[model samples]
Target: MTSLLAILIGCLYAAAIYMMLRRSVVKLVIGLILLSNAANLLIFTAAGLERGVPPLIEEGQQVIAGTAADPLAQALILTAIVIGFGVLAFAVVLIHRACEVVQTDDMNEMKGTD
Candidate 1:
C-alpha cells in the first residue's frame, strides 16, 4: 500500500508540475492545489500507516504505549487542508481579478507593458 501510495504521490507531483507549466492561469491555480495536496499526501505517507487504534493513553502511562495511529499526521494534514483551502481561494480570487482586467486567462496574453 505504501509503495502504491508513493507512486500515486509521484504521479500527482508530475501532473502538478506539468499543469503549472501550461500557458493558462487556471491551470496554474489547479497545479498549485495539486502541489499542496501532494505535499500533504507525502507527509501522510511519511508517517507510518497503522491500523485504526485510538491514539490514547492511560493516565499513568507516560506515552501512547501501543499500536495506535499517530495523531500528529492527522493534525498536520488537517492544518494543511485548511491552509491549502485558504491559499487556493486567494489564488482563485486573484485569477478572477486578473481575468477581469486582462480579459483572458492565458499567461502569454496577460503580459502587457501598459
Candidate 2:
C-alpha cells in the first residue's frame, strides 16, 4: 500500500506540473489543487503507515506502545487542506474577475504581461 501510494504521488506530481504549464486559467487552478494534494500525500508517505494501532500511550506506558499512526502527519494534512482550500477559493475568484474583464481564459490576453 505504501508503494502504491508512492506511485500515486508521483503521478499526481506529474499531472499537476503538466496542468500548471498549460495556457488556461482553469488548468492553473486544477494544477494548484493537484499540487497541494500531492504535497499532502507526500507528507503521508513520509510519516509511514502504521495500521491497527492508535497513536497513544496507555496508563503507565512511557512510549507510543505499538504501530501507532503519526498524529503530526494527520494534523499537517488537515491544516494543508484548509489552507489549500482558501488559496484555491481566492484564485477562483480572481480568475472569475479576470475573465470578466479580459473576456477569455487564455493566459496571454492580460495587458502588460509577457
Candidate 3:
C-alpha cells in the first residue's frame, strides 16, 4: 500500500510540475491544486502507514497503547486541505478578474498590462 501511494504521489508531483509550466492560467491553478495534494500525500507517506487504533489514552494509561494513528499527521493534512481550498478559491477569483481586464488567459498575453 505504501509503495502504491509512493508511486501515485510521484506521478501527481510530476503532473503538477508539468501543468505549472504551461502558459494557461487555468492549467496553472490546476497545477497548484495538484501540487498541494501531492505535498499532503508526501506528508502522509512520511508519517508511516499504520491502520492501528486511534491515538487515544485509557483512563489509567499515561501514553497511548500499542500501534496507533498519528494525530499530528492528521492535523497537518487537515490544515493543508483548508489552506489548499482557500488558495484555490483565491486563484479562481484572481483568474476571473484577470480575464475580465486582460481579455485572455494566456500568461504571455497578460505580460503587457501597463
Candidate 4:
C-alpha cells in the first residue's frame, strides 16, 4: 500500500512540475494545487500508516498501548489542507483579475505591466 502511495505521490509531483512549467496562468494554478496535494500525501506517508488503531491514548494510560496513528501528522495535514484551500482561492481570484486587466492568460503577455 505504501509503495503504491509512493508511486502515486511521485506521479503527482511530476505532473505538478510539468503544469507549473507551462506558459498558461491557469496551468500554474493547477500545478500549485497538485503540488500542495502531493506535499500532503508526502506528509501522510512519512508519518506511516497504521491499521485499526486510534490516534489518541486511553484516558488513564500515560501513553498509547500499541502502534497508533500520529495525531501530530493528522493535525499538520488538516492545517495544510486549510492553508492550501486559502492559497487556491487567492490564486484564483488573482488570476481572474489579472486576466480581466491584461486580457490574456498567458504568463509571457502578462509581463508587460508597464
Candidate 5:
C-alpha cells in the first residue's frame, strides 16, 4: 500500500510540475495545490503503515517501546496543510488583482517598457 501511495504521489507531482509550466494563472494555482498534496502524502507514507494499533498508549497494555506510528509526520502534514491553504488563498487574491488591474491573465502580456 505504501509503495502504491508513493507511486500515486509521484504521478501527482509530475502532473503538478507540468501544470505549473502552463500559460494560465488558474492552472498554476491548481498545480501548486496538487504539489502540496503530493508532498503531504509523501510525508504520510514515509511514516510507515501499521495495522490494528491505536496511536495513543492504552492503560496497562504493556506494549514494547518505540514501535508505533510516528506522530511527528502527522503534525508536520497538518502544519503544511495550513501553510499551503494560506499560500493558495494569497495566490488566488493576487491573481484576481492582477487580472483586474492588467485586464489579462497572461504573463507575457504583463511585460512592459522593453
Candidate 6:
C-alpha cells in the first residue's frame, strides 16, 4: 500500500509540474492544487501507515514500539493545505484582476508589453 501510494503521489507530482509549465492561468492554478495534494500525500506516506497505540501520555496508556502513525506529519500536511488554499485564492484574485486590466490570459503578451 505504501509503494502504491508513493507511485500515485509521484504521478500526481509529475502531472502538477507539467500543468504548471503550461501557459494558461487556470492550468497553473490546477497545477498548484495538484502539487499541494501530492506533497500532502507524500508526507502522509512517510509518516507510516500502520496504526498503533495513540501518542497520548496518560495512566495505563502506552506508546507502540513499531510503525506508529506520526502526528507531526499530519499536522504539517494540514498546515500545508491551509497555506496552499490561501495562496491559490490570492492567485485567483490576481489572475482575475490581470484579466480585467490586461484583457488577455497569455503571459507572453503581458511580458511583451513591459
lDDT of 4 by residue, 54-95 (tens): 867788879877787788889999999999999899999999
Each model's lDDT comes to 0.92, 0.91, 0.95, 0.94, 0.86, 0.87
Which residue pairs in candidate 1 collide? none
RMSD of each: 1.3, 1.9, 0.9, 1.3, 2.5, 2.0
**What's model 4's lDDT at 6?**
98
Q: Give the per-residue lDDT of model 5 (tens digit) for 1-114.
A: 877998899999999999999888888999999999999999888887774344677787776355666778889999999999999999999999988888877777766513
TM-score (C-alpha) between model 5 and the true structure: 0.85
Highest lDDT scorer:
3
Scored by lDDT, model 6 comes in at: 0.87
Better of 3 and 6 by TM-score: 3
lDDT of 1 at 45: 93
The C-alpha stretches of model 6 lying farther than 4 A from their native spots are 60-68
Per-residue CA lDDT of model 2 for 4-99, tens digit only, reads 999999999999999999989999999999999999999988998767476768899898765777788999999999999999999999999998
Ranked by lDDT from best down, the candidates are 3, 4, 1, 2, 6, 5
Question: Against the true structure, what is each candidate's TM-score?
Answer: 0.93, 0.90, 0.95, 0.93, 0.85, 0.88
State how far residue 1 of model 6 sits from its true place (Å): 0.4
Model 1: worst 10 consecutive residues (lDDT sum):
105-114
Error of 3 at 78 (Å): 0.1
Model 1, 73: alpha-carbon shift in Å? Answer: 1.3
Compute the lDDT for candidate 3.
0.95
lDDT of 1 by residue, 86-113 (tens): 9899999999999998889998888962
Error of 2 at 93 (Å): 0.4
